[model samples]
Target: MESGKRKIRHEFLALRNRMSVDLVAVCSAGIFAGIKKLSAYEKAKTVMFYLSCGSEVVTDFMINSAFGSGKTVIVPAIKNSGDEKMYAAKISRLEDAYLFVYGIRQPEINSGNIVEKNNIDLVFVPGLAFDIKGYRTGYGKGYYDRWLKGVPFEKTVGLAYDFQLTNQLPIEKYDLPVGIIVTEKRVVQIKGDRGADRWETL
Candidate 1:
């Protein structure tokens, strides 16, 4: 399952990389607008790191809005030798977030603002593709899955463009399903308790 997931994620990454600049811009704008709409809900008090890709970038847009409205925001800072696990880092300034050439946004290693996962109220997840059923295929590091183990959050939201979404995805026993998925076009509500709806898809 891990190998198959890696192959699919690689294929999707290649396709996303080949998108024309115009299309990329349009998708980014649409996804950003969708995130902004979510920020207006005013229900979340604290949110976990937003996992995103180069095409799925969500700048301080949602973070700033949430912070301004009194919500605590956090971002993931991957740890470990192979970057297979991550810890949440609190971010307040635009400068606090740094871009990595490999298509991830993270805070500096010594940023000194990291926090525990239990402190998070919501988490914005990322995926190569996700289905209406809530299964998500990530980069295969199992970082989010490992980190989310046992920790509780009010909501776990997957952030993606509509194109990155599908009807299903290959899932592993270790893979975690999100409670809600937010795309540029729509929001999908999955069945089951928070992160328990793991469906196997290929």
Candidate 2:
């Protein structure tokens, strides 16, 4: 399963990397529009957003828009400790971020404003690929999975481009699925209960 997931991850990464800058920009705009239309996003007072890096769906627009709308924005910061645990740090501006793992921008950990898991109202997850069912293949780090274990599935969302959506993906017992997937083309709501959902895309 790990090998299959790795292959799928690489394939999706290559496809995303091949996208033109203009196309990425256009798709990102459409995705943000769809997110803004969601009642969950509208009602959330505090949101967690992953900073985009490489071929991932761009999230600067969403982050900035959240700030402009007076929403509390929290970005993840990786700990250098052996556990490499992920923490939610409050970021007031983009300048609060610095290059972290794999040159991905992350908020400063020492900011002294870590947000509690229960305080988070919404979470926008980043990944290499996602199926309509909400199972996602990340960079193999499992940071998002571990961090999301405590959050309610209904508040978790995966942001992706249309091309990244596949029909199915390899799943593991520890792999956490997102409750909803927002793509440039459409928003898919996974059906059934939270953790035990059948992994069916609605």
Candidate 3:
């Protein structure tokens, strides 16, 4: 499963790297629009969003919109500490959220503002690819996987492009499937196993 995941991850990374700036913006806008239409996001007071980097779907618009719309925005941040665990840090300003870049001076994030896991109402997850059933594989860090364990599935959503959706994906013991996945093509809502009535495609 690990080898399969690695291969799929590489393929998706290469695919994303080849995308034009216009394509990324267009698809990301569509997905972001779909998110805003969801009742889950509408009801969420505090939302956790992954700071996008590299060729992954850009989240700047979504994050900035959240900041201005009276919603508490939380981004994943790691303090300069021995522990490598990803914590939910509330960021009021876009500059406070750091990016994975070289030669760029990073802003110091105060660990004192770490929010509890239960405080986040909605989470926007980033992934390289996602299966039709909503299982996703990321950059192999497992940061979101570990942090999102035990989180209600309905509250978590995966952001991806239309081409990133595959028929199947490798899964591991700790891999938790996403409850909803939004792409430029459509929105997929997965409640449980395939037999569940909650399984839906929007």
Candidate 4:
């Protein structure tokens, strides 16, 4: 099982690297559209978004757009050792950063209350690939999975570029799935608990 997981992660990372220029443009458009659609279902006043790296869908627009929408914006930064998952800290703007224990950019010291699991309203997740069933392959770190364990499944959304959508991903006992996979192209809802169905590429 460990070997299979490693292989899958390798192949998926290769797929991401091989993405074409045209695919990136289309995926970005799809992600913008998906975010528009998701705005309607959001009811939480405090929403969590993450900073992007590499080919992750650009979240700057979403973050700025959500600023005055009456919802407080929060971003996650690593707070503890690698063994501990990333933690969320409230921020008023995108530029603020503090040197957290893990050396990652985080909210200012004592800027806001520490994020308690399940206290979040909506969580915008970034990943390498996600199936229609909502199973996602991340950076081989269980950060989000560990942080979201007790949170209600309904509030989780995997935000990705369309190319990152895949037909299926290997699922393990500790691998938690998202409730919906949203790309710039479309939103794929997982059919059953823990995403039992094969993921259909967006």
Candidate 5:
């Protein structure tokens, strides 16, 4: 099962890396627009987002917009230690010289900026691939999955391009599914009760 996930991740990574800059921009814009229209996004008092890197969908627009939308913005940052863990750090602005993880810049992690798990109303996730069922394959560190375990599933969302969606993935017991996924073409909400899913095309 792990091997299957690794294979899928590799394929998705290659596909994402081949995306032209203009294509990424266009797709990311569409995905963010879909996110802005979500009722949950408007009502969210505090939202957590992952800063984009490489050919990944750009999230700076969403983060910047959140800053002025009267919502507290939090990003994941890590303190280098033997233990590999990510902390949700609330940031007033994006700055440099904090730390870098896999080419992605992260803010300084400290007690003052760490937000409580319950304070996050919405969390924008990063993944290599996701299935229609909302299960996602990340970089294998399991940082986001562990964090998601503590938050209400309905509050988490994944952002991806349309091609990143797959039919299914090998699900692990520790894995948690996102409640919503916004692609370049649509917004998919997997019901919290795991009943019927709602799909909205843009």
Candidate 6:
């Protein structure tokens, strides 16, 4: 299973890397627009967003917009310790972030700015590839999986470009699925009791 996942991850990463910068920007804009239309996003007081890097769908627009709209914006920052864990840190401005972990921007570690997992109402998950079932293949660290284990699945959403969607993906027991996936083309609510009811388009 690990080998298969690694193969798929590599293939998808290459595909994503080939995408044009303009296309990523346009798709990310559409995705954020769709997110704003969700009831969960509108009602959430505190939200966690992954800072985009490389070929991933950008989150800069979403982060800035969240701050502008008075929502508490929390971003994932890597712990410098040996355990390779990640924690959510609150940021009032984008300038608070510094590049870390493969050049991905993250908020500086500050005890006063750390947010409790329960306080986060929503989380924007990152991934290299995803299936209609909401299963995603990240960069193999399992950071999101471990971090999300404690959070309710209903509050998690994956953002991806239309091309990132695949027919299916290999699943493992520890794999945490997103409640819904927002692509540039539409919003897919993975069927299950985990959260959400049906899929819809923007």
| TM-score for each predicted model, relative to the true structure | 0.79, 0.93, 0.90, 0.82, 0.93, 0.93
Writing each residue's lDDT as its tens digit, candidate 1 over 85-178 gives 6778887765666676356777776557878777677778877787766778877767788887775422677776677777667777777777
lDDT of each: 0.68, 0.86, 0.81, 0.71, 0.85, 0.86
Cα error of candidate 3 at position 81, Å? 8.8
- The residue ranges of model 6 lying beyond 4 angstroms of the native Cα positions read 194-202
How would the candidate models be sorted by lDDT, starting from the highest? 6, 2, 5, 3, 4, 1
lDDT of 5 by residue, 163-201 (tens): 998767788998888888999898887765654443434
Candidate 2 per-residue lDDT, tens place, 59-174, comes to: 88889999999999998888763555888999999988888766779876775788888999999999888875678899998888898987888899899998888877899988
lDDT of 2 at 180: 88
> What are the per-residue Cα lDDT tens digits for candidate 4 across 97-181?
5555423456653546566656678888878877756777877777887877776777888887666776777778887778877
Model 3 TM-score is 0.90
Q: Which residue pairs in candidate 1 have backbone atoms (N, alpha carbon, C) closer than 3 angstroms, thus clashing?
A: 170-201
Model 1 spans > 4 angstroms off: 36-41, 51-53, 79-83, 99-103, 109-112, 152-154, 193-202
Clash-forming residue pairs, model 4: 30-184, 30-185, 31-184, 132-199
Report the number of clashing residue pairs per model: 1, 0, 0, 4, 0, 0
**Model 4, CA-based lDDT:** 0.71
lDDT of 3 at 170: 87
Q: Candidate 2, clashing residue pairs?
A: none
Pairs with backbone N, CA or C atoms under 3 Å apart (clashes), candidate 3:
none
What is the C-alpha local distance difference test score of candidate 1? 0.68
- What's model 6's lDDT at 119? 96
Taking the tens digit of each residue's C-alpha lDDT, what string does model 3 give over 1-202?
7898899999998999999999899988998989988999988899988877766788878989997889998887665544457778887777765544331122355756788879999999989998866788988877788888888887889999889988778888888888899887788887566323433676
lDDT of 2: 0.86
- The 10 consecutive residues of candidate 6 with the worst lDDT sum are 193-202
